[model samples]
Target: MRDQEPAPVERATRRLSTKETAELLGVKPETVYAYVSRGQLSSRRGQGGRGSTFDAAEVEALARRNRRESTPGSSPDELSVRTRITLIDEDRYYFRGVDATQLAARHTYEEVAEWLWTGTLRPGARFTAPKESLAAARRAVSALPEHSSPVDRLRVAAVAAATADPLRYDLSEQSVLGAARALIPTLATAPPLLRATYTDGAPIARRLWGRLSHKEPDEASLRVLDMALALLVDHDLAASTLAVRVASSARAHTYAAVSAGLGVLEGPLHGAASGLAHRMLVDVLDRGSAGLVVADELRAGRRVPGLGHRLYKGEDPRAQALFAALEELPAAHAALAAARDVVATTARHTDLHANVDLALAVLTTSHGMPAEAGETIFAVARTAGWIAHALEEYGERPLRMRPTGHYVGVRPPQPLPTQTGRE
Candidate 1:
């Protein structure tokens, strides 16, 4: 064969400055550095090796990926409510402009709740359940079926507590704050405790610990629980929070609005995720390997619970915080190891990261808490956020959340169908 001519050399690809890369990606220069740190984009020393530079092609591709991931395939008119509570940006979230994880690390759940309710963080803030409201809630929750989920019991308790408070209809900020403080503790103490110990004047987490676990909690475990509650107090307008907002837009009282949120939280995709994760962890521990349990789940056509979150691209921040806290407890070592194993085994098939649900599972499983304990914790913790959102919605025009139906059905012109009672 004839000798082939050497191919012409191609030009080197362009390298962009950090500012250019940030502009292309529609993010800040700091975010560009974050992307580099996360390995999403690579950077090289600039011309004289003074600054970093990124490949134009890689930056463009990353920008395209970001656009695709961010813009949802929903109508432009999709519900958008204005609020000044939580703000979720990329992997991190903030509460009233303060880092939520930092707050969780340093403050009690009550203080964080107070901060969310009012701009002021009250040191040593304690929420006390009124005797009448607590008694009513306990009676109503006790009347539920023995197998009722914690959320179900909570919903009942909210309604009963509402009935007990003659001022439930008061939507004034001060009145709502009072109701919120009272209602949170009432819900925390409503469920039947595993032990008969009274934690009347203790922090909400301490009161809730006795209800969720028979084992006495060490300080580390109690601290973890308190942090978990604080971290979970708010997360933008979640489905349940939106529900609470809608109820509040119609002028629902604090307890009623909170009940609306609790109702939505009972769905499998929401508050029930941790319970499922707990069960999965138990199965993994019993099977002696996460690989086997993960395989069974995939074989059953199920996505592994407690992995990945829509709002986070990396590991859930809440999960990171909880896992770090969990490491401090010697008792949580085994369950935490199992959770890590689950993450490692699943990574072979997909790139999902562990979310807060998995961390919650580790806590509940290691501490002898029931699978539903996570749900109870979520319900009690998120009640604070729900109250904040409800308070915000109360200030807006009534029924402002009502959306005009698009009328995609039979345009209201079809004749009434004949009665076909007996087929």
Candidate 2:
């Protein structure tokens, strides 16, 4: 809703960190960056070795302008009213007003992805021929190097499979989303790890061309992965979103936009932490107890990864959905069970609560999924959101991003034609 009048403007009192500026906009850093791209805000570059920060007052003013445009009585701005795809934000992300935790409880991965992509809750809306899709995905998996990480193989297969999508270029939101739903699962579940290869020396069969990969994935495991992917499908304006928007602003095609987002996702801030957390759980399990090991880590002042979120002071809502999914799995490793016990043991402070990352760690390990696959799964799932945000950004009016207070060095006069010896 529009603000009838500006709130009393406060004087520029302090420098705000990028994270703080992001909070002020009620959006993620990615969204604030969009504002920066539009010349709506100015960032200050400090002269010292420290990094740049923003003027709180300037950002507040920009935020105020946005608030005014959204005022209840005022007509919607053209940019806000654009009919492009909504990648990161959905309608409350609550299908039929039911939270995802409840939905994941009863539904399968196919059901959830369909619901997310189509906004339908019925099972019929899911893959009509899931068996065929599975077969094709399995065939694609062989294309990857067996000795290499299964996760890498999975990601490459997804990209390769997505290449067949002729309709990806269609600017229509419905068509693109339809493609995304079809692709997400085929990409999300990696082919069962080669049994003989791991147990004893063996070889792979000839690559099947679009042959269905009907290895009969552990249903519970897939459901957990699916739920995690769905919950994380979109978050408003993350770094990946910024990369997608920047690409789209250049009028790049949908695939290019998604590719840009995936590149950004490869970085630690956006996606790698999930696997690292899972690895930590493994380490504790390997040590036989979380007590001395965890204490030693804490003693060294080492902050563990994937414990919480930068934005969510409270428990991540997505985590609850993942935790529920993990519970439904019929078989979980002994190690996971031990980790759960340790987590409960320190409920007061360390229990702090698992985010989507920790939940995913629990889900994959319990289901016997490869450790390497976690980050890749995140990349595949979030690709849909990236494309959506990219399209939304393309329609926005052009704005220049200007950085200020960019000082180079102390002011020193240019040495007047220095004649070293004579002068």
Query: Using lDDT as the measure, which candidate wins?
Result: 1
Clashing pairs in 1: none
Q: How well is each residue in 65-167 modelled by candidate 2, as lDDT tens digits?
A: 6444244565543223222223222222343345655565676444555555445555634432144554666677766666745345555555555566666
- Score each candidate by Cα lDDT: 0.89, 0.56
Cα lDDT tens digits, model 1, 1-423, are 999999999999899999998778765576677678657899999877798999999998876665431236656676666578999998999999999999999999999999998889899999997899998998899899898889889999999999999998878788999999999999998788896544678899999998999998878899999999999999998999999998997888999999999999999899999999999999988988999899899899998999999999899999999999999999999999999999999898789999999999999999999999999999999999999998777754456667667767767678988887776
Against the correct fold, how does model 2 do in TM-score?
0.59
Per-model TM against the reference: 0.82, 0.59
Q: Model 2, residue 421: displacement in angstroms?
A: 23
Candidate 1 segments exceeding 4 Å error? 1-75
lDDT of candidate 1 vs native?
0.89
